[model samples]
Target: MYPEPMSKSLEGKLVVAISSRALFDFEEENKVFEDSDDRAYMDLQLSRLDVPAKPGVAYPLVKKLLAFNTETDNRVAVVILSRNDPVSGLRVFRSAQEANLQLERGVFTRGRNPYPYLTSLGANLFLSAKEEDVRAALNAGFAAARVYPDSAVAADRHPDEIRIAFDGDAVLFSDEAERIYAARGLEAFQAHEIERAAIPLPPGPFKPLLEALKPLQAQPAGAPMRVRTALVTARSAPAHERAIRTLMAWNIQVDEAMFLGGLEKADFLREFEPDFFFDDQTGYCDTAARVGPTGHVVSGVKNEVGGPRPSDR
Candidate 1:
């Protein structure tokens, strides 16, 4: 066996923080809480304590990510940070064990929000089923998303290849152009993009996570499937130049870039069939979730606490 590395500070490791619901199917239990009460929900969860929870939308993506840790030097950590009380947490641990997920750390905050502990975990990404918690995580300066439970499970094509897709603005780049579009519409946003074609948008929360993947991408060719990435943005034609140029300026090369303007991403994503997809808008997130593993990046101006819903626009 290879000697494992031990790092107290998580140095040289990619840490992911996720909620129990995002990693496992909790719709039935959540419905119990909504239809009756928390006490009743706890009772149900307790009764089924030994039963392993079914995998949720993020399961395939997490499984592929954990595969990269097959070597001792390559480190990837996933922690369960959930609002589930300690009593209900017994099932969560049992489920992870049944799934063979090497999760050893978690924070059970009961009814309290758990976003505050994300920093302590040195998390590069946070995924949960709760929109409020995701927004809180983003506001706290972490790459976070709200996973949709109804998303289809990922296809295991190219078992060795791990492909991930990301939205350009808001999710990867700052919400700069998104703010303009929200205020003055698409025409203005396009003109602004043309004007700043040479200027690279500032990095968004996920930039760190993307940068972290660089080392993994550099692995030897003989290694089992490597990581492949794509940028699927809603910007087309003139506006697309800025996003392309920005990535060039950053010296990062994505395997593919789809510039779909005002088109429903669900069908397009259905064809691409990525392990996961992340977007800031709820409409896209909700739609894509039905096709495959998806995460709702909740950052940018549109998600402001008091702002109107993006679907209203």
Candidate 2:
């Protein structure tokens, strides 16, 4: 009998699964695919096999995350979980190589839903340009977001740090308070949060993603690569207490917290210059994207039809 083959493991590593479109600037090529059929797309990609595609919105984040891995410790793993065919995948891998990314694993589903494989890869987060795949991953209890293809790329100011920002409701914590705000008004919402300030809000979809980042944040000072996180929210003053208390209750610490109380978040995000920012409401995401890379977390009441509009937050 032949001996059993040994399977490689991604255990004890933070695994990120990203779509090819999210990792590289395939907009032009994707336009061709959208206008034509699969054969045309494959032929175009094969023809440009020697060409290295430009970096996409998520490239800076992925590049910094991969820097955590070292010869002695492989702390992070980035895998291409794409919907392109095998033929086009060659260009994707070539792009990553030319960009100096040490990506080694990928799953190309040929225009099919690829989120199902996230569980097999033990993905801590999934970023894609397709909303359907992101929703599927979120429904399956994985942290996922849909990247805006036209969003601005991250600034090169912080070369060695991976800076990320997230909204409070529906992103890091449950949207229970947001529901009350939607049905009632700001006064009622503040009253409700003040009443329950002692109670920690329930975990949100991206809570696990934040928790997973704690270890990376804990890397020793002067480490080659570091992580910084922020909580940027519309809740201010009285309502803010609950959000802070919630993080304390969960034993997670964010480097910065902005309680804008419904102010425009773009200016603040521009100053912070995050590699990526995630918010449940597309309105906030739209503005933030103007400053830096942004993702729409399509969760909570704000995203529902006829629910509270972005202004309500």
Best by lDDT: 2
| Candidate lDDT (C-alpha), each | 0.85, 0.92
Q: In candidate 2, residue 210 scores what lDDT?
A: 86
What is the per-residue lDDT of model 2 for residues 1-313, given as tens digits with 9 covering 90 to 100?
A: 9999998899778999999999999999889989998889899999999999999999999999999988988989999999999989999999999999999999999999999999899999999999999888988999899999899985476998999999999899988998888888889999999999999999999999988898899999999999999999989998889999999999999999999988998989998899999999888898888888999987888777565574647
Best by TM-score: 2
For candidate 1, lDDT tens digit of each residue in 1-313? 9888865776678888899899899999999988998788889999999999999877877777788887456578888999988889899999999999878888999879999999888898899999999888888989988988888885476588778899988889998898888888888989999999999999887888888778778778987758889898889989999898888888888888899887888888888888889988888888888888898888888777797455422
Candidate 2 pairs with clashing backbones: none
Model 2 segments more than 4 A misplaced: 1-4, 305-312
- Model 2 scores a TM of 0.96
Q: For candidate 2, give the lDDT of residue 130.
A: 94
Candidate 1 deviant stretches above 4 angstroms: 1-7, 308-313
Worst 10 residues of 2 by lDDT: 304-313
